[model samples]
Target: MQKLDRAWLDRHPLPSPAIGGDKNARGRVLVVGGAEFVPGALRLTGEAVLRAGAGKLQMATVRAAAMSLAVLMPEAAMIALPADDDGEIASGAIELLGERLANCDTLVLGPGMSASERTEQLVAALLRGASAGQTIVLDAAALTCAGNLGTLVAAHEGRVIMTPHYGEMAYLTGIDAETIANDPVAAAERVAEKFNAIVVLKGARTVLAGAGEEAALFEGGSAGLATSGSGDVLAGVIGGIAARGAVPFTAAGWGVFIHGAAGEHAAKEIAEIGFLARDLLPAIPKLIANFGAG
Candidate 1:
């Protein structure tokens, strides 16, 4: 395992384009997940992606949450997927979603989605339909939606990045939270190898692991990051970077480090006790600037 530090940042700097290129030169990201009850999750993630420097952003969410989310984030193009009685996106919306995803460089799936049969179906379909080059960042409810995660991921030709907290990690791998917490690197590695995807095992110190790559450990976040919606923001940061052309592994490593830095900055400014997830959004650009992307 490698320690994620300034040295690593120097080795793998963030992606940057020449000054003359247009917005599309940076990247395009599509975020697809939001339920009636927690519609704010996708909004938070979308805004974070823009703040992280994605050139274009699109949000596809349930019908009930569409208007408010569009109003909340006018910068993103919003697509309202048909919803079921519970206002969760319907499985039938997959056809339309697949069409929209064709143009996007990165897909951020499952933020604030309900863990229902419908949701699982939608996630499975989306995974099956994703293009070979699309970068998929699966988080929150999507982690629980994959019934045969290994088979599903292996079938897909695209790069898949899975972000799971200890509880979610336990659910995905059938490994107890206690065991994962004790040795997160091994747990993350197991998941990565099984799924043929990059795994971001989120915690106080996040672990980034992939099938054939060295595991990377990031170690500088604060208690403020324990707040709700934080992981969604991290997903956005990673998705945004991936949209900008960083490979899945690079994006995950950089995202973890940037997120931890932003959390620490937010905590320092507002004190660890009261910082919100949104507070970390604005801190992202500054951290990226300091890192000096190339």
Candidate 2:
């Protein structure tokens, strides 16, 4: 596996904005997922994507969480999905999402969503409906909801990127968490080859792999990144980068580095133990600025 060092990151800078370009020039991103009970998850993700330089943002969430999430993230246009009695996004919401899918350059799925049969149905529908050339970043419950991830990802023609922690990776690959933890690069690469999509197996040192590409590893984040909603932030950063035209593997690599760098910044300020996930948001722009400066 190749190590993602500062030099490598500096070489792969994010797309620079044009002098007279409008918001659309940076790229449009749609984040789809958020339940009533976990409204903060998608909100964190949305904010992270904006901070990571996505030009326009849209959020598609459950009806109950829509208004509040909109208030939390005024920058993103909000789309309320139909909800079932349990406050989960209903299967029927697929039609509403289909109407908006073509408008976005990137689709971020699964943050803050509940894992259920309904969620599986929704994921399946979205996967089937996703257009060619649109990037898909899957995280949290979306990873678990898919009944046949390989088939779904293959159907997308390798445009999908999945972010799974050890446990989620176990569920997706049927490899026990312990085995995955022992050698994450191998596990991530195997899953990447099987699914024909980019696989980001998140941990202390994240591993990234995709079909026909060399595996890469990043080791820089602090324990501050272990907090809740942190993975959502990572997903958002990657989605934003992908929306701005980075390929799946490049987006994942850059996202992993930026997340780890932001974690280090947050840890230095608040100390690793007490820093919250939101603390990482403010650090993102500064890191990007430093990248630009270098």
Which residue runs of candidate 2 sit more than 4 Å off their true CA positions? 292-294
Candidate 2 has which clashing residue pairs, if any?
none
Report per-prediction Cα RMSD to one decimal: 1.3, 1.3
Over 252-283, each residue of candidate 1 has an lDDT whose tens digit, in order, gives 88899899999889888999878889989988
What's the CA RMSD of model 1 in angstroms? Answer: 1.3
Report the lDDT tens digits of candidate 2 across residue range 1-294. 688767767666667677788889888999999887887789889998999888999999988889988998899899998888988888889999887888889999999987898888888888888898899998988987763656977777668999999999999889999999999999999888888899999998899898998888888889878989999999999998888778788888888888999999888988987788888998887787686566
Model 1: which ten-residue window has the lowest total lDDT? 149-158
| CA displacement after TM-score superposition, residue 80 of candidate 2 (Å) | 1.2
True-vs-predicted CA distance for residue 290, candidate 2, Å:
1.8
**Per-candidate TM-score against the hidden true structure:** 0.97, 0.96
